[model samples]
Target: MPRLNAGDATRREAAGHGPDFLEALARGLAVLQAFGPERRQMTLAEAARAVDLPRATVRRALHTLVTLGHLESDGRLFRLTPRVLRLAAGYLGANGLSSILQPRCEQLSAQFGAPCSAAVLDGPEIVFIAYGQPARLLNLTTMVGLRLPAFCTALGRVLLAGLPEAEMEALLQRHPPHAVTAQTELDPLRIRRRIARARSEGFALVDQEAEQGFRSLAVPLRRHDGRVVAALNIGMHSERGTAAALREAVLPTLRAQAADLACQFL
Candidate 1:
């Protein structure tokens, strides 16, 4: 084989191993993530570079997304539209857990006088799908489509802990770690240990990981086939319960709500 230039090598890699469900999914998600916090609006060149996609490929994808109303452009720059929420809306509409469990979360909140929520893993982050609260004073701040780091959230752990050991190990290897807070775990080995505990115990708890002064308990929402598709959580002040107390008081309610939500998948 003759020596190949960098561009040629990149092209060869980008061409991939041919089409499959995973490749198509990866490309679509790449196109979506090309628009981000800092680069909300981008020109064709910018979006292509941002996603490391060929310019023509990005252009076609952007055009398709625009036609579908998931993206909008002002002749020069493209940005996402509120219509993009419909993509996430489709998932929530199909998953009855988020729709049903939300009201129960409200009941749990009324009974315990705390806020509760449900979340689903979207790539490396967890997206809040539904929430219920007793009072609106505390700033839980998460919205329907808002995303947060999976590694730093109880909701993430509950869903992750439900994964097979090999798959979870692979995911940890792929993610490695980056510190989000003083309490964030940066070591994959340590994270695996915590996930193992969660898997055995059927729930996960976090204190001041995603945000300070907040505590949450989460249980996996399993489908009829016994696969966890999402996580259910209740959030409150860390002072609401000690770790033990959180497991005792909050975990049961979260588990009950998770059970109720699981029926929808069945």
Candidate 2:
């Protein structure tokens, strides 16, 4: 089979995209995603390398993004401008999840005296969309738009548990579980079993998996139609307590809030 270029309309169409699949738009978005908090400023060569696109292709995409005010270039280096934040703002503003969940997450954070977050699965990773914070200084960095591997995070596990078995297996294959810390689970079969258990039990708990000192507990946030659309989680230091203790602390309140929000989706 030939490799399908994500930016090639003919390639995408031949691979199953219809006329409605705008390859140029997809390519442009791909280019935008190449720039993150770390890759703030990048030259054309760096951008090409980051997105695995040809220099010419990246050039066109960069030019298009700059023309649309999503990016700005200073001579040789290109970087995302403040306009990019507007894109995230639009999603948070338009989605009812932010308004409804932010308050609830804030309440949870206050109750637990830690950071609370809501995230949704994005292929092999989970992207935090909403967050709440308490007065305590914490090391968890799951701010909005942050992405972490699905196989290693409590948020990701709960969200993945909501997926169908075939979809979950495919994503796990793509991501391939890794042991981030000594406690991280690396076996794919065991990971699958854990996700299955989370689906049955309606929550997931991971300790020192993605971060060295972090412990996380997550539950699914379902839509009114009973589809799990997101994961809500609380983060604390590993010094806090065991997973069972954390589960006992917040499980009831988390489950209650999730259930209440499920009926209030817009």
Candidate 3:
């Protein structure tokens, strides 16, 4: 994926509600978010380039974060401190969705001997909030807070199918789909159709599109009022079955779990 740039930041700032927007705070959070698995540490110049902000601006943000104990620097290279995880902890603690879904996901994983997960849509990606996997399955790397492309994963497609047409179109335009594997569908029209099918069918199934050897089936987790708040999915190796067979086997169980969860939502 391309690094977030100054243009993206500028557009976000512009999109923000006028006077109440704190540009400094936004910049600081942006700088913190720029750090990820691929970028664990960076010098001031490297940090600036990653966020595409000026060195001075990024320097101030870095120093502020360091002062707050969220980041640590060893004279030259800066990296996130363990304190940064408190932010994620606060969210996970406040949000009851993960707590409610985790046990059910674990049950599903145990029943099917595969990985089960729950995620919510965020911009062009779906952020995993809860996950469960069989002990023997070591090939899949899913975990809480993992982000995957929204256009490619079964969970993402289910969530995307819940979006309003205009919002979905805008999101598609902003972040055009890219191929993650040879089986990934890159055509926007086809992707939209797949999402539509998910909406109509109340489930989505993908065969080795997001990953080479795994297939997933997903269903939307909706509120009591019918608003989709997240998605639930179970993933297994491609060798387990064909996509149609997988759906026939697991879709009912996935939908039942989703419905059970929905009743708990407001």
Q: Of the candidates shown, which would achieve the greatest TM-score relative to the real structure?
A: 3
Q: For model 1, how does the per-residue alpha-carbon lDDT over 148-219 read when each residue is reduced to its tens digit? A: 888778899877888777877777777767777787877777777777778899988887878878888888
**RMSD in Å for all candidates:** 4.5, 3.6, 4.8
**Native-vs-model 3 lDDT?**
0.91
Top candidate by lDDT: 3
In model 3, pairs of residues that clash are none
- Tell me the tens digit of each residue's lDDT in model 2 across 131-187: 888866545664889888888898998899998889888878877777778888898
Error of 1 at 243 (Å): 3.4
Kindly report which residue stretches of model 1 are placed more than 4 angstroms away from their true locations once superposed: 1-29, 138-142, 223-225, 239-241
Model 3 lDDT per residue over 17-134, tens place: 5545666798899999999899999999999999999999999999999999999999899999989889888987888898898898889999999999999999999999999988
TM-score per candidate, chains pooled: 0.80, 0.91, 0.93
Of 2 and 3, the candidate ahead on lDDT is: 3
What ranking of all candidate models by lDDT puts the best one first? 3, 2, 1
For each candidate, the alpha-carbon lDDT, in order, equals: 0.78, 0.87, 0.91
Instruction: Give the TM-score (vs. native) of candidate 2.
Output: 0.91
Per-residue error (Å), model 3, residue 57: 0.7
Query: What lDDT does model 1 reach?
Result: 0.78
